[model samples]
Target: MSNSIYDFRASRLNGEEEQLEVYRGKVLLIVNTASECGFTPQYAGLETLYRNLGVRGLVVLGFPCNQFGAQEPGDAAAIGQFCQANFGVSFPMFAKIDVNGDNAHPLYNYLKHEAAGLLGTEAIKWNFTKFLVDRNGQVVERYAPATKPEELTPAIEALL
Candidate 1:
C-alpha cells in the first residue's frame, strides 16, 4: 500500500499523469467536488484560500466526484471548462473519480483510512468533503461537506 499521497499518481484534468510527490512539502486541502452540489460555491472560497496562502505552501487539490446525486455528470473537459468559467478555478483539478465504494480512487481510499469522517466512519458522506494534509504528507484532519473552506484557514495556517 502507498504510505502517503506522494506515493500515488492521479490523472489530471488534461489526462496527464501527475505524481503527488510534486507537492511533497506543501500543505494540501484535498477536496472531492461536484459541480451541481449546494456547496459548489465553495469553489470560490477554496480558490481564495489557495490564492491567498499558496505562497506559504498551501496547495488546494480538487478531485471531482459524481457519486452523490449524480451531481457531476460532466466529463473531464466539461468539468474543467465549467470550473474555470463558473468559478475561475485555477488550482489543480483531477479527472472525476469515485470517492467511495469499490471503484474509489486509491488516494481517496488512503485519505479516508487515515482520517475517518464523523462518528469514526471511513465512508465519505457527500461531495465537497475536504481532507487536510501536513507538509509531511500525513492526513491531518477531515472536514465534513458542510464545512466552509474559509473556516479551515486556522487549521491550514497551523500546518503552514
Candidate 2:
C-alpha cells in the first residue's frame, strides 16, 4: 500500500470527524481495543503513556471493537464512559469500528498492509493489536494483541 496514512479519517465517539492528517509530525500508536477482553487492562498503561508523552509528540489513538468474542459490545457512549471511569483514559477514542472484515475501516486496512504481524501475516489476530506510525505517516511497526502499551515506551520515545 501507499505510504499515505494521512488519507483517512475516522468518526469520533462524540459524532465528529477526526482527520488522521491532523496528527502529522507526531508518533502515533493506533490500537484496536475491547473493554472486556483479556487485554482490556492495557487501557490504563496506554493512558499513562499518553499522558506522559503527549507533549513530546506521542499520541495513542484507541478504536474499540467487538470483532473478537464480542468483548467490546458497548456503543460509542458506553465505551467512552467505561474508559473514563475505569481507566481514566483521556486519549482520543474513535467510534466503534471493525478492524477485520469486509467492513473494516480503511485506516486499519492500511496499517495491516504496511506493517504485517507475526510470520508476515497482515490480518489482526485479536483485540488490542497496535500499529505504530512514524511522523512521516509511515506504518513502522506492528505489535501483537498481548503487547502492553508500557512495553512500547522505548520505541515511542525513539520516534519522538
Candidate 3:
C-alpha cells in the first residue's frame, strides 16, 4: 500500500470507482457516517463546511458505515436520497463500508494508522468519526464522533 491518501480508491455513491488521486492537492475531510446515529446531524454541518469552503479547496467525503449500530442500513441509493433531502449534502458520498475489523476499507485503515483515535487506538469508536487530510494527502488529525463538523472550519481554513 502507498503512504499517501491519494493511493487508495473508493466507490462513489453513484457506483463509480473514484481514484483518490483525483483529490490530490485538495484538503479532504473524510468521515465514517450513519443515518440513524445521534451524530447523524453532523451531516448538515459537514455540508455547510463543504459548500462554504469548497471553493477554497476543501472537500468532504462521506463514507456510510453500517458497522456501528447498523445505523446506516440503507443501500447506496437510499443513503444518497436521505442525505440530499435531509441535509442537502452535496459533497462526495461513497458507498457503504466497514470501518473496522478485517473488512475495513484500505483508505480508512491508512487514516487510522496515520491518526489514531483517543489513547492511540486505531479502531473507530462510532459513526461520524472524522479524519482530516492535508493538501499533500497526509492524515493530519482525527476527530471523535462527538466533535461537530463546524468546529473543523479553522483547521480546514488553515490547510486551504
Candidate 4:
C-alpha cells in the first residue's frame, strides 16, 4: 500500500493527468473548494499565500467539490473560469471531485486517514476543509472548514 500523497494521481482541470509526485519536495496545502459557499472568499487568501510563498516550496492545490450543499455545480471549464474571474486563483486545481463518500477521490481518502478531524473522525465535514502535507508527502495536519487560510501561514512556513 502507498504511504504518502506521492502515490496519488488526479486529473487537472483541463483533464490532463497529474501525478502528485511532481510536488514531492514541496509543502502542500490541499483544499476542497466550492465556488458558491459562504467561505468562498477564502480563495483570495489562498492565492495570496501561493503567490507569496510558492517560490519557497509551498504549493496550494484546490480541488473543487460539489458534495457540500451543491455549492460547486459547474463543470470543469466553468469551474475553472469562475475561479479565475472571481478570485484570480492560479493555484493548481484538479477536476471536481467527491471528497466524502464511497466515490471520494483516492488522495482525499488517504488524507483523511492520515489526519483525522475533531474526535478522530475521518469524514470531511464541509467545503474548504484543508490538509497540510509535508515535504516528504506525509499528511501533517487537517484544518477545519472554519480555519481561515491565513491562519495556516505559520504552519506552512515551518514546513517550507
Candidate 5:
C-alpha cells in the first residue's frame, strides 16, 4: 500500500474510476455510510457541512457499506436516490465498500491503519465511521460512528 490517500483510486456511484489525487489539496471527510443505520441521519449534517465548508476546501466523501447488520443493502443507483431524496446529499459519494474484514477496500484499509479507533483497534465497529484527511492526503484522525458531524468542525477548520 502507498503512504498517502493520493495513491488510491475508488469507483464513484456512477461507476467511473475516481483518483484521490484530484482532491490532493483539499481537506477531506471520508465516511463509511449506511442508509438504514441509526446514524444515517448524519448524512444531513454531512451535506450541510459540505455545502458550507466546500468552498473553503473541505470535501465530504461518502462510501456506503453493508458490513454492519446489512444496513445498506441497496445498489449504487438505489443508494444514490435514497441519499438525494432523504438527506439532499450533494457531495461526492462512492460505490458500496467493505470497511472491515478481508474484503475491505484498500483505501479503507489504509485509513483504519492510519488512525485506529477506541482502544487503538483498527477494525471499524459500525457505520458512519469517519476518517479526516488533510490537504496533503494524510489521515489525521478517525471519528467514531456516533460522533456527530458538527463535532468535527473545529478539527476540520484547523486543517483547512
Candidate 6:
C-alpha cells in the first residue's frame, strides 16, 4: 500500500466529505464500532481519551459497523444519536463502512496492510477493532476487537 493514509476520503455522519488529510500531523485511533456489541461501551473510554489527549494532538475516529451480528443496525442518524446520548462522544464519527470483505474502505485497507494483527493477519475479525496511527500518518499498531481503549494509554503516550 502507499505511505499516505491521507490519500483516502470518507463521508461523515452528516454526509460531509472528509479528507483524511484533515487528520494530518495528528496521532489517530481509528476504530470500527458496533452500538450493541460487547465492546460497544468502549466509546466512553474512547471519548475520555479524546477529551484528555485531543489537545495534545490525538484524534479519535469512530466508524460504526453492522457487519458483525448486525449490532449496529441503525442508520447514520440513529448511530449518531445513540453515541451522543449514551457515551457523550465528541470524536469524529463517520458513516458505516465494512472493515473487511471486498468493499472495505480504502483507509481500512491501508491500515490493515500497515499494521496487521496477531501473526500479521490483516483481517478484522469483529467490531471494535482498532488501528493506531502515528502523527506522521503511519499505522503503528493494530488492536483486537477485545482490546479496550484504556489499555492503549501506554502506547499512545509513547507516541505522543
Highest lDDT scorer: 1
**lDDT of each residue in 66-106, candidate 6, tens digit only:** 88999999999999999999999999999999888899988
lDDT, ranked from best to worst = 1, 5, 4, 3, 2, 6
Give candidate 2 misplaced runs (Cα > 4 Å).
Answer: none
TM-score comparison, 2 vs 3, better candidate? 3
**Alpha-carbon lDDT, every model:** 0.96, 0.92, 0.95, 0.95, 0.95, 0.91
Each candidate: RMSD to true structure? Answer: 0.6, 0.9, 0.7, 0.6, 0.6, 0.8
Clashing pairs in 6: none
Q: Candidate 4 clashing pairs?
A: none
TM-scores of all candidate predictions against the true structure: 0.98, 0.97, 0.98, 0.98, 0.98, 0.97
Mark the 10 consecutive residues where model 2 has the least summed lDDT.
Answer: 1-10
Estimate, for each residue in 50-158, the C-alpha lDDT of model 5 and write its tens digit.
Answer: 9999999999999999999999999999999999999999999999999889899999999988999889999999999999999999999999889999999999999
What are the clash counts of all predictions, listed in order?
0, 0, 0, 0, 0, 0
Winner on lDDT between 2 and 6 is 2
Candidate 5 similarity to native, TM-score: 0.98
Query: How big is the RMSD of model 3?
Result: 0.7
Give the residue spans of candidate 6 off by over 4 A: none
The TM-score between candidate 2 and the true structure equals 0.97
lDDT of 2 by residue, 1-160 (tens): 5567788999999989988899999999999999999899999999999999999999899999899999999999999999999999999999999888899999998999888888998788999999999999888899998888889999999999
The reply for model 5, stretches above 4 Å from the true place, is none
Per-residue lDDT of model 3, residues 30-110, tens digit only: 999999999999999999999999999999999999998889999999999999999999999999999899999999889
Better of 2 and 4 by lDDT: 4
Q: In candidate 4, what are the lDDT values of residues 46-134, reduced to their tens digit?
A: 99999999999999999999999999999999999999999999999999999988999999999999999999999999999999999
